[model samples]
Target: MAGAINATDASKRYAVVTGGNKGIGFEICRQLACDGVTVILTARNEHKGTEAVEKLRGLGLSDHVLFHRVDVTDASTLSSLVHFVNTNFGRLDILVNNAGVIGLVANESALKTPEERLLNMMGAISHNYELSAECIEINYYGSKRMTEAFLPLLQQSKSPRIVYVTSGWSKLENIPNEWAKGVLNNVESPPEKLDEVVNKFLEDLKNGSSKEKEWPSRMSAYVVSKAAMNAHARITAHKYPSLQVNCVDPGYVKTDINFNTGKITANEGAQNIVRVALQPEDGPSGLFFDCNKIVAF
Candidate 1:
């Protein structure tokens, strides 16, 4: 336990949602708050995060919602969050890792309509080593960092939950590199081994051998990162039997990630994630969810 366990905490639940300034992330915060859980709405941009919290407060969730600035890719920010939780709430009951990037570098002016954009995104967007590396850093490693930092605080809770907002692309089958896929698909693989797999992907990408290596040609980093994230979530669930850890693909919800071309609304997508996050203590763990249904990882 990081701080003196508050007597009042026994009856109260606390949650933190990353990238909570917009889209599905923002909705997750709102829904969790509505569910009676105190929520820390976090974002890399302080102004946006503050604005989001104010909006939630305006919705009459002032007592349940607050803003915190965090950049998942930065360890300092994560440490700061850990300190804040330890000092204030004393324990963390829920953590929703929703911060992610699409890994596509597109020319906005060249992109016309959502229909055409969705159909021809691959052709219009470009992928480079830097962007690919950043995607992996934020999507995969960033989630891992948040999990690791909060594990101690989470352990203090009677019922802890960890949700990784992954994607359907995270399915191992989407990873064309059989060797990489194999490593990630093996839930028994250690975290270091998973790191090695992601590192190898980056190495191959930087060397311009990703094509020869049989990795995904389009949105390669996004797919690989989410795959790694799903694998890590499984491993984490097993490692911490006291915690409910799961990965969720909230369907293709319409948000900025896909140029708002996705089919469903952000609220619909977030409900799927919030449902998993609020699963009962006896609920199943180490599973991949496609919206409300459990699917293969």
Candidate 2:
């Protein structure tokens, strides 16, 4: 067997954050790098990614910060991330699956008053079949893909941790569909089963029966996707006893997803995620956190 690692050795640890160009993702990368962990800040656009890294460097975080391009929706781009990490770092200690979408379009032109726009932005959203499908593809499947790709490297570390950036919307009570809630709430539920629920949600929208089927009428897809992401975090923790796989619901923060109407700042929202990602060797796994405290999934 390979020798065990010294959990206290911070210099050897490394992390990769998806969608790190802006908002919460960017803050996570900045904070992690500040803590001495070599961080790869990934973004879909190369120029934006480099700029984000440069901003970090300007703050004297140049020693361990780097940039990479990754579009969670593209398979080849994801594979490239895996290869880059493997070839450069050889192993990974933390993986933050932060890339996600709100799954709804804003009709800014239709609204007259800023209050009306802010109200619409802060409130629930309506989604279509295509929007929901893509939301699931990225928010849920994209996280899954990134996790699977980095699992080997994570296993090599003594204190491997996976943090899923979920939301309070992931709570079962928010999802009106009892069947979907039951599947996700079951701690032993597998990924295949979660996929089944998500697929059915898209099908419901296609059949024009989303309301009749009991999906959340507003932000249905986004809610379902986060719920599924939470479930996957539980499943992964169960499947990997050697690793600490946890999900965190970073409370509503002012970011692009919520159109800057949130109560907290991105840095405030990222603190909990960073906490989960840097959990100790014996930290709790298979758990969900509403920021810093462990809560039900």
Candidate 3:
């Protein structure tokens, strides 16, 4: 572990970013560090995480960045991270849940460009129950666990913030399943409602009833998980008024997750997220932003 934050750094803002080894997450760490916020760049792989930190350090941000291994799907790692942050920084000012996986398997060779893939996503990609389950586990539940584990430390901060990297496809209008949509769109619904919606989707998936049940036929899990993530952010924001919690769709950046076929750069996408994470204490909560503009959730 790196040295504990000293008294001279007591007034600095501290952040923990999941999946910080590459792409948008990496750029998020860089941007935050450039802004003078102390960042703990985390990934499931220690080597990659450390290397990313070193890269940032090489840019003369040695004092602003560090690395810690964190697998969001694992409870022990999450717990360890919570303890690490509490011990080192005393409190966490920002938590960016940037880790996610696309549930669909794409035939990259069939598509030559980002525009091609975006238009013919259904024909190019296929999804299975296993992949769908894993998507929900990491994208939705992983973020939930991170938020719950860090809530105590966040509450201690003077300007706590939580930023979930969601997708534009997660908008309520895109969800075909009315039941799941209702549960998610209802801000009054309890957190348990999210579990109900997720469990139902998995069950339907396992039983081969997803399409018949009106769940998205292509990229179903990615859409559902992000939708759930957005809903969870709303519930969390309402439950914890002191925290500035928001979801952002980073505008399809050219990241590995999308086979580097996106329209924008990783830095551009990360800028969207970093903008929300560094919002002032008086900033709005429980809102979704498409890039930098506020949009309906």
In TM-score terms, which candidate is top?
1
- How good is model 2 by TM-score? 0.92
Task: TM-score each candidate.
Answer: 0.95, 0.92, 0.94
**TM-score-based ranking, best first?**
1, 3, 2
Question: Residue by residue across 1-297, what tens digits does model 2's lDDT show?
Answer: 101222434357888899999999999999899888988899988989999988988999877788778988898988887887777777889999999998876668788755567566436444656877999999999998888888998998878999999988878888889999999988798678998999999998898888888988767888899999888888888889999998898888888787677789999999989988887788999888998877776
Q: Summarize candidate 1's per-residue lDDT along 36-96 as a digit string, tens digits.
A: 9989899999889998988988999888888789999999988988998888888999999
- Model 3 lDDT on a 0 to 1 scale: 0.89
> What C-alpha lDDT does candidate 1 achieve relative to the native structure?
0.88
lDDT of all predictions: 0.88, 0.85, 0.89
List ranges where model 1 is wrong by over 4 Å: 1-8, 124-126
Query: Positional deviation of 206 in candidate 2, in angstroms?
Result: 1.2
- The local distance difference test score of model 2 is 0.85
Model 2 scores worst on lDDT over the 10 consecutive residues at 1-10
Q: Which of the predicted structures, 2 or 3, would earn the higher lDDT when compared with the native? A: 3
